[model samples]
Target: MNTELPALILGGLAAGFAIFSIGLAAVIGPKRFNRAKLEPYECGIEPTPHAVGGGPGTAAGQRFPVKYYLTAMLFIIFDIEIVFLYPWAVHFDALGVFGLAAMALFVLNVSVAYAYEWRRGGLSWD
Candidate 1:
């Protein structure tokens, strides 16, 4: 009759199902293999070389721009901030002024990082 027992049972069932599915796939899936199938793929499309890292005459494989990394980092920073904010917002009433002050500081810290990134041209695109 315990609420937590059902949750634990469900979690165990989910984990067991995942393991069973993986094993089933390995047994029932295609056994054939080749160089083409083993090679890395992106959206099933052949990758093209770019002029980012390699020079005009030099060759490149999956070369990416610096902006891509900067953008991904920025996304992660904001995403984590939102995750933290959601929990705090759900219990905002219980947290009171202390929670408000804590969140304000957290937001200010994130804002400073954002401003720093903005000033460093992390938001700029070529």
Candidate 2:
């Protein structure tokens, strides 16, 4: 009863389950196709053909609200920063002054970037 053997077996089972679920879904999924179904739909609006090299008036790579992307990116950046900070905090005694200063610098850098972005209207909902 080796521990490694069970771990390996579990890993293989998980992989097989993933493959099986994907295969099942592919086989059971709907086969119907239509212009509306195949086309890209955004906000219930149908896509329009794009001119060569693209243009703003056309649907070809048209501009969207940047706030959505910026908000998501800011969320992920802060989330990862918090993840790193948590581990360091747990080992604060071992890290000592060097760790404290390093974390301070890290936070300051993030704060400056955040301030710059905010001032530049990146954080604006409008």
Candidate 3:
């Protein structure tokens, strides 16, 4: 018997189960529809129409501020830094001084960007 056969079977079972669950939900779940339900919801904020372009035409939803994207990017950067740090920490002894130096440099680079953002008010919500 192949060693990977069990893994393949488990994966197939998981996929089949997921598909079955979605199909079951669609068939049995409530189909209620209303105007309020159909409208876009954003953190309890009422949806408002805004101009898509600088022209006269208006769109259905408000455009997000650039600060939202900036905050998300910063979160992702720090999250990725934590991800790299985890593996390095787990293999700390094996990697020795080389890993330490590499991680130190990585952290320094990230800190510089963090400081720059702080100084530029990128971290501030307002």
Order of quality (lDDT): 1, 3, 2
Q: Compared with the true structure, what per-residue lDDT tens digits does model 2 show for residues 1-126?
A: 697999999999999999999999899998899977876756443344654435756545544445677788888887787788888889999999999999999989888988987899877776
User: How many backbone collisions does model 3 have?
Assistant: 0
Each model's TM-score?
0.53, 0.53, 0.60
The alpha-carbon lDDT assigned to residue 94 of candidate 2 equals 100
lDDT of 1 by residue, 19-71 (tens): 99999999999999999888886543456755456766776645554566668
For model 2, state the Cα shift of residue 115 in Å: 0.9
Clashing pairs in 2: none
Sliding window of 10 residues with minimal summed lDDT for model 3: 52-61
* Prediction 2 TM-score vs. true: 0.53
Please tell me which model should have the higher lDDT, number 1 or number 2: 1
Please state the error at residue 19 of candidate 3 in Å. 10
Local distance difference test, per candidate?
0.84, 0.80, 0.83
**Could you tell me how far off, in angstroms, the CA of residue 92 lies in candidate 2 after the best superposition?**
0.6
